[model samples]
Target chain A: MKYLEDIGSYFLMLRRTFSGFTKADVLRELIFKEINDLVMSSLGIVSFIGFFVGGVITLQTALNLTDPIIPKELIAYATRQSIILEFAPTFISIIMAGKVGSFITSSIGSMRVTEQIDALEVMGINSLNYLVFPKVIALLTYPFLIAIAMFLGIFGGLIAGVYGGFISLDEFIRGLQEDFIPFHLVYAFVKTYVFAFILATVPAWHGYYMKGGALEVGKASTKSFVWTSVLIILANYIITQLLLS
Target chain B: MIEVENLKMRFGSEEILKGISTVFEQGKTNLIIGQSGSGKSVMLKCLIGLLKPEAGIISYHNKPTQEMNLNQQRMLREEIGMLFQGGALFDSMTIEENIMFPLRMFSNQSRSEMLLRVNEVLSRVNLDGVNTKFPAEISGGMQKRVSIARAIVNNPKYLFCDEPNSGLDPKTATVIDNLIQRITHENNITTIVVTHDMNSVMEIGERINFLKNGLLVWNGTQEDIFKTKNEDVTDFVYSSNLFKKIRDVQNS
Candidate 1:
C-alpha cells in the first residue's frame, strides 16, 4: 500500500510539474543554471570513470581470449560493444543517479525544510514547476553527455589496447569499424533520453515531499539515489526488451 | 481586514486548531500569542492559506478564500506577504535579488525600476548597503529585516509573520517588532503575527488574540492585557519574573 501511494504521488507530482508554467525568462535562467550544475559540472567525473572503465574492459577481453585462433582485433570489438551498449549509457547513468540524484534531493529537500518551497507557494508561484521543470529540461542534454562519454570510452580503449599489448593500433581500429550497427547507437540514445527524465523527476519527488529537518534531507537523498537507480535499471531492462530483443 | 470564522485544522488524528475564530484589523499589528503546542502557529498557517482548515471561512477584504477562482487566488496570494520564523530567505540569492524576486515575478517593472524599489524597501527596513551579501553573511536580525523587506517589496495588502522574533536578542526582537508595526501602520496593511514573546506582545501588539489549546481564550489590546482579569491570559503573560514585576509596578 505504501508503494502504491508513492507511485500515485509520483504521478501527481509530475502533473503539477507540467502545469502552471513559470514565465519563459525565469525558466530560461533556471534551465541555464541547471545545465551548468547538472551537465557541465559532471564532465570531469564522467570522463574519468568512462576512460578507466573502458580500459579495464579492453584488458579483461584481451586476457580472456588466450587462443591464437581468436583474432586480436576482437579485443577492441568487445570493448567498443560493451562501452556503447551498456557501460557508457547505463553505467554512467547509474553513477549520475548517485551524483546528480543526491544533489537534486538534498538541495530541494533543504528548501523544503527551510520553508523556501512554502515561501514560493505562498507567493503564488507554482513551486513544482519553478523547481523541477528546469531540471527536467536541462537534462535534455543528457544524451549529449553520453555521446561525449562514448567518444572518450572508445578512445581510452584504443590507447589501452595498443599500449597494454592487447592489440596493434591498426587492428584495434579495424575491429571498431568491423561490425558497427547504426541501430545500436540509436538504441543507446533512446535509453539515455529515458534515463535522463527519470533522473530529474525521481529525485525531485523524494526531495519535494520530504518532511523533517537536515537529517531527513540526508536520508531523502539516500532514498532518492536508491529509487532512481532501481527505476533506471528497471527501465533499462524494459527498453532493451522492447527495442533490442 | 482579515476575518477567520470557526477555523479548524488537524493532523491525522490530532486536532491542532479547534474552531478558533478571530478578526485581524487593518493598519494594526494584530498578534496571536500562546505557548508552544497551543495552536498559534497552526492558526497562522490556516489564516495564510498554507494549511486549509478542516472547517472555516477565511475572508480577505470580505471575499472568502475558498470561493476565489484560480486567477483570484493567484491575485490574492500576490497581495499577501509572509515573514517566516527562520527568515526563510533564499540562500542562493543576494539580498537585492531576494527583495526583487516578487516584483520580477508579478510586475511589469523594468530591471532598473525593480532595483529602485528593492533599494527603497531595503532602506525602509534600515538594512542599507548590504544588497550584495547572501543571507548567510548577515546576522539573524538582518536576515529577518531582509525577509521583511522582501515581504513588503511588492507592497502586499496583507502581511503574516510567524514567530518573527524567535531567534533574535531582546533588543533586536524589539526592533523587528517596531519595524513590523511601523510597516503595518505606514501601508495600512492588515498584519497578523504569531508569537509568544511578551516583549513583542507588549510592544507592538495593537490587537492581541491569546490562544490556549487550540481555543482563543482572550481577545483585547495591549492596554487591556494588564487590566483584564482572565486567568489564562494573566498566567501566560506574567509567567516571567520580569513581566510579573512590571505588572506589580503597574498595580502599585
Candidate 2:
C-alpha cells in the first residue's frame, strides 16, 4: 500500500513539474546549467565505457564462432548489432542511472535538506518546475550522447576486429552494411528518448520529496539508482517487444 | 502586520500546533520562544505558508491568505522574505548571486541594478565586498548575515527567521539578534523569529509569544516576561541557572 501511494505521488510530482513552469529567462539559464552538469560531464565515461564494451563483445563473438561453417564477417555483424541495439542505448543509460541519476538525486536531496526548496516556495516560485523541468529539457540532448556512444562502440569494435585478425577490415565493413535496417536506428532512438525521460524524472521524484537529513539523502540516491535501473530494463523489454516483435 | 488566528497543524495522529492565534506587529521583532518540540517552529512555518495549518486564518495586512488567488498569492509571497535556520543560502551560488536570486526572479531590473541592490543589502548587513565568496567559505554568522541580506534585498513587507542564532556562539548570536532587530525597525517590516534562545528572547524580543506543547501559553513584551507570574513562561525562559540567578537577584 505504501509503495502504491509512493508511485501515485511520483506521478503527481511529475504533473506538477510540467505545469507552473518557471519564467523563460530563468528556465533557459537552468537548462543550460543542467546540460553542462548532466550531459557534457558524462561524455568521457560514456565514450570510454562504450569503446571497451564494444571491443569485448567483438572478441567474444569471434571466439565463439569456432566452427569452420561460421563466417568471420558474422563477428562484425554481431558487434554492430550489440553495440547499436543494446549497448549504446540501454547499457549506457544504466551506467548513467548510476552516475547522473545519483547526482540528480543527491543534489536535489541536499537542497531539500537545507531548506532551499522551502525558500523558493516562500518566494512564490514553483520549486518543482524550477528544479526538475530544466533537467527534463536538458536531457533532450541525451539521444545525442547515445549517438556518440554508438559511434565509439562501433569504432572500438572495428579496431578490435581488423587488427586482432578476427576479420579483415574489408569483410568487417561489408558485414556492417549487410542486412542493415534503418528502422533499427529509429527503434533505438525511441527507446533512448524514453530512457532519457526516466533518467531525468525518476531521480528528481526521489530527491525532491525526500525527508530527513544527510544520511537520508544518501539513502534516497541509492534507491533512485536502483529504481531507475529497474525501470530502464523493464522499459527496454517493453520497447523491444513492441518495436521488434 | 501579520495576524494568525486559531491556527492548528498536525502530522498523522500527533498534533503539533493547537489553535495558535497571535499578531506580529510591524517594525518590531516578534519572538516565538519555547522549549524543544513546543511548536514554535511549526507556528512560524504555518505563518510563512511553508506548512498548511489544519485550521486557521493567516492574514497579511488585512488580507486572508487563503482567499488570495494565484497572482495575489504570488504578489504576497514576493513581498515576504525568509531567513532559514541554516542560512539556507544556495550552496552553488556566490553571496552576490544568492542575494540577487529573488530580485532576478521577480524584478525586471537589469543586471547592474540587481548587483547594486545586492551590494547595498550586503553593506547594510555589515558585509561589504565579499560578493564572489561562497557560503561555505564564510563563517556561520556571516552566512546568517548573507541570508539576512538576501531576505531584505527585495525590500519585503514581512520577514521570517527560523532560529536565526541557533548554531552561533553567544557574541555572534547577539550580533545576529541585533542585526535582525535593526533591519526590522529600519524597514518597518513585520519580523517574526522562532527561537528558544533566552538571550535572543531578552535582547530583541520586542513582543514575545511563548508556546508549550502546541499551545500559546503566554504572549507579552520582554519586560512583561521578567515580571509575569506565568509558570510555563518562567520555567522555560529561566531554565538556565544563570537566568534563574539573574531573576533571583532582580527579585531581591
Candidate 3:
C-alpha cells in the first residue's frame, strides 16, 4: 500500500515538476548551474569507469576463449556488443544512480529540511519547477554523456585487446565494423534518454517530499540511490525486452 | 491587514488549530506567543499560505485565500515574505545572492540595480560587507539578520517570522526584535511573528495573541499583558517574570 502511494505521489510530482515555468532568465542560469553540477562534474568518473570496465570485459573475454578453434576477432566483437548494448547505457546509469542521484537527493532534501523550499514557495516561485525542471533540462545532456562513455569504453577495449596481446589491432578494428547495426546506437540512446528522465525525477521526488531534519536528508539520499537503481534496472529490463526481442 | 476568521486546521484525527480568529494589522509587530506544541509554527505556516486550513477564512485585505486560484495565490505569495526559525538561508548561495534571490526570481531589474537593492537591504539589516559570505560562514545572529534582509528585500506586504531569535544571545535577540518592529513601522508591513520568547513578546508585542493548545486564550498589547488578571494571562506572565518586575515597578 505504501509502495502504491509512493508511485502515485511520484506521478503527481512529475506533473508538478513540469507544470509551469519560473522566470526564464532565472531558469537559464539554474539550468547552466545544474548542467555543471550534474553533468560536467560527472564526466571524469564516468570516463574512468567506462574505460576500466571495458578493459576488464575484453581481458575476461580473451581468457575465457581458451578453445584455439575460436577466432580472436570474436573477443573484440563481444567487447563492442557488451560496451554499447549494456555497459555504456545501463551500467553507467546504475553508477550514476549512486553518484548523481545522491547529490540531487541531498541538495534538494537539505533545502526541504532547512525550509529553503518553503522560502521559494513563499516568494511565489514554483519550487519544483525552479528546482527539478532545470535538472530535467540539464540531464537532457545525459545521452550526450552516455555517448562519450560509449566512445571511451570502445577505445579502452581497443587498447586492452591489442596491447594485452589478446587480439591484433587490425582484427579488433575489423570486428568493430563487422555487421554493426545502426539501430543499436538508436536503441542505446533511446534507453539513455529514458534513464536520464528517471535519474533526474526519482531522486527529486525523494528529496522534494522528504520530511525531517539533517539526518533525514542523508537517509533520503540513500533511499533515492536505492530507488533510482531499482527503477533503472527495472527500466533496462523492460526496454531491452521491448526493443531487442 | 490580514484577517483570520474562525480558522480551523487538523492533521489525521487531531485538530491542531481549534477555531482561531484574529486580526494582524499593518504597521504593528503582531506576535503569536505560546509554549511548544501550542501550534504557533503551524499558525505561522497557515498565515504564509504554506499550509491550508481545514476550515475558516484567511483573507488578505478582504480577499479570501481559499478563493484564490493558482495564479491568484502566486500573486498573493509574491507579496508575502517569511523568515523560518532556522534562518533558512540557501546554503549554496552567498548572503548577497540569498537576499537577491527574490528580486532575481520576480523582478526584471538590471544586475547593477539588483546589486544596489541587495546592498541597501543588507545595510538596513546592519550586515554590511558580508555579501560574499555563505550562510554557514556566519554566526546565528547574523544569519537571522540576513534572513530579515532577505525577507524585506522585495518590500513584501506581509512579513511572517517563525521564532526570529531562537538561538541568539539576549542582546542580539533584542536587536533582532527591535529591527523587526522598526521595519514593521517603517514599511508599514503587516508583520506576524510566532515565538515563545518573553523577551520578544515584551519588546515588540504591539498587538499580541496568546495561544494555548490550539486556541486563542488572550489577546492584548504588551502593556495589557501585564494588567490582565485572568489565570491564562497570569499563567503566561508567571512563565516569564519580566512582566512581573514591570508590574512590581508600576505598583511601587
Clashes (N, CA, C under 3 Å) per candidate: 0, 0, 0
Which pairs clash in the backbone of model 3? none
TM-score per model over all chains: 0.99, 0.99, 0.98
For model 1, the superposed segments whose C-alpha errors exceed 4 Å read none
User: How well does candidate 1 match the true structure in TM-score terms?
Assistant: 0.99
Error of 1 at A85 (Å): 0.7
Ranking by DockQ: 2, 1, 3
Clashing pairs in 1: none
Q: Compute fnat per model.
A: 0.82, 0.88, 0.97
Error of 1 at B108 (Å): 1.3
Q: Comparing 1 and 3 by DockQ, which wins?
A: 1
lDDT of candidate 3 at residue A108, scale 0 to 100: 95
List ranges where model 3 is wrong by over 4 Å. B241-252
DockQ of 2: 0.90
User: Model 3 over residues B117-209: C-alpha lDDT tens digits?
Assistant: 999999998989999999999999999999999999989999999999999999999999999999999999999999889889878999999
In lDDT terms, how accurate is model 1?
0.94
Better by TM-score, candidate 3 or 1: 1
